[model samples]
Target: MMGHAHALSGIVGWMAVVPLLDGHEFFGLRFDLGPGEIVAGSLVCAGAALIPDLDAKSSTITQTYGVVTRGLSAAFNWIFGGHRNGTHSLLFALLMGGLTQALALWSELAVQIFVFLLLGIAFNGLGLGNDKNRLASEVINAMGTAAVTLALYASGVNYAWIGVAVAFGCLLHFAGDMATELGVPLLWPASKYRFGRNIGFTTDGKVERNIVTPGLTIAILLLSFYLFPWPELLPQA
Candidate 1:
């Protein structure tokens, strides 16, 4: 799915986790970012949410992730056993998280970049979806969620509940990626289960289900009133 489409659909798909997370608001994790920073963080989170689609190569969004990510993704796919290896694995997410923390300790700027970018990768891992490797996928998602929430709180949105909401919301992005037509390597190093990632279309966002993303995203944002109660005043999701 494209960013806009992913933005919309992700909210709905990740909703599945609501039951697992219970009443906790996972995606609303607020960071201390000023309006600008919050915008950046949200964008980063959304981008992270979309990272898993790069493998398809046919996807415009995936191609846009850049040659480094794309090349590395391809190489990783070859070495780690497609969606079932390093990229989709929890071990990988931890590795990335640990790396992010270490980098964060290096400098404030580094922390922000690492936090956002690494979270993106972790989100991609989570969105890999029901790929027989749910364990790996969940681990990555957990780590990604923690990293994102920590950043949110550390940045300034200190409410722990908000962090939970942030985690839940971001995971929804990953899940949304599942419904795409290509596939998400949700689990790595254990199972190669390609999650949803199919909005009726195959590549290029030309599928029938693509029509559902906008409505789905709006629905999710609306549902957040009862579920999260966060103030997303932008009115421009």
Candidate 2:
């Protein structure tokens, strides 16, 4: 799947799970999330949905950070046996979620530092112009966006849910890939099993554009309405 498709899937997945997490139980555990937590989770999931594709240099996520992601992507490719290996695996998802949870202990500081680093990457990657003045302007813009994000965090947003959202987003990425012809290695290291072989259309194929993407988009819109129904739709008393 493409970057936008994966992002849509992640958002839909997060929204679908929100209601379940609010008062439902799963595997002997329960979640009681509030509105702010749900928003944070959705944002994190949407952002992390692009993480698996970091291995591909031409991928949207990679280009977003430009050269800053090269080393990390290379490291991942080396460790996971290239593009669709470990990074797309269930093990990777669990590890990422656990790491996020651990880091959430210093949520405020962690978020601030992360925002700063991300802005720095954006400043370098925006490809506005090589001129010093243009570069400086882009940097300022990136910093301004980061500052706004930091302010939002300081305004009482819960960061713990971010980790959970990222984990779920990665998992949804795997699921989206599974719908492609190439499939994904759901289990890695222990076995080289590639699941979802030929189950759906090829990458960027006609069916994907005409059927899958549109279907997912419609589902997302419907789910959004289900989650937050309009007041105008209420019956008149």
Candidate 3:
């Protein structure tokens, strides 16, 4: 699947699961998902959804931070055995979640900085800026990312569940790819089988561009209204 589609899947997947998680404990972490947490998790998930593709040099996530991400992509490609191999596996999700959770546990500032970076990636994936102008796009993406991060910080958003969200996002990405013709190898190394291969629509084809993408966009809108307390958020008349 394409970058935007993966990003959209991340958001929709997170929001779809938010109600089940809002007041529950899962995997030793208690979730108290408020508005800020919802938004933060969605963006973080969106960013993470692009992570499996980091092994692909031309992936949106790889191009997100230029030299930094490019270098990371090269390393991941070498370590994971190229695009759609180990990085697309379940093991990759666990490692990413573990690393992100460790970062959160280690330093609040580091987590915040990481969130800022992920938000920037999410914005780029969602095509928030005019890509025709590369410099302008980067500047705009940076500004937008900063604003959202600051707002979430001011709202006292707690990111205790960030690791879970990241892991879930990567899983969602795998699901998206599984829906495409070139399916993901969810159990790489253990088995070289590519699950769901040639069993779905073509990537970025009619199904994705027309049906999937639009459907995801509409879902986000509907979920926004359903998940958020509009009356509480609105200014008093």
Name the candidate, 1 or 3, with the larger lDDT value: 3
The candidate that wins on lDDT is 3
Residue 70 of model 1, lDDT score: 77
lDDT tens digits by residue: candidate 2, 170-234: 89888888888766888877778998978877877898789877887798788767776457547
Number of clashing pairs per prediction, in order: 42, 0, 0
Alpha-carbon lDDT of model 3: 0.94
Per-residue lDDT of model 3, residues 1-237, tens digit only: 899999999999999999999999977899999999999999999999999999998999999999999999999999999889999999999999999999999999999999999989988999999479989988999999999999999999999999999999999999999989776778887988898888888888999999999999999999999999999999999
What TM-score fits each model? 0.48, 0.78, 0.98
For this target, which candidate reaches the highest TM-score against the unseen true structure?
Answer: 3
lDDT of 1 at 98: 47
User: Ten residues in a row with the worst lDDT in model 3?
Assistant: 180-189
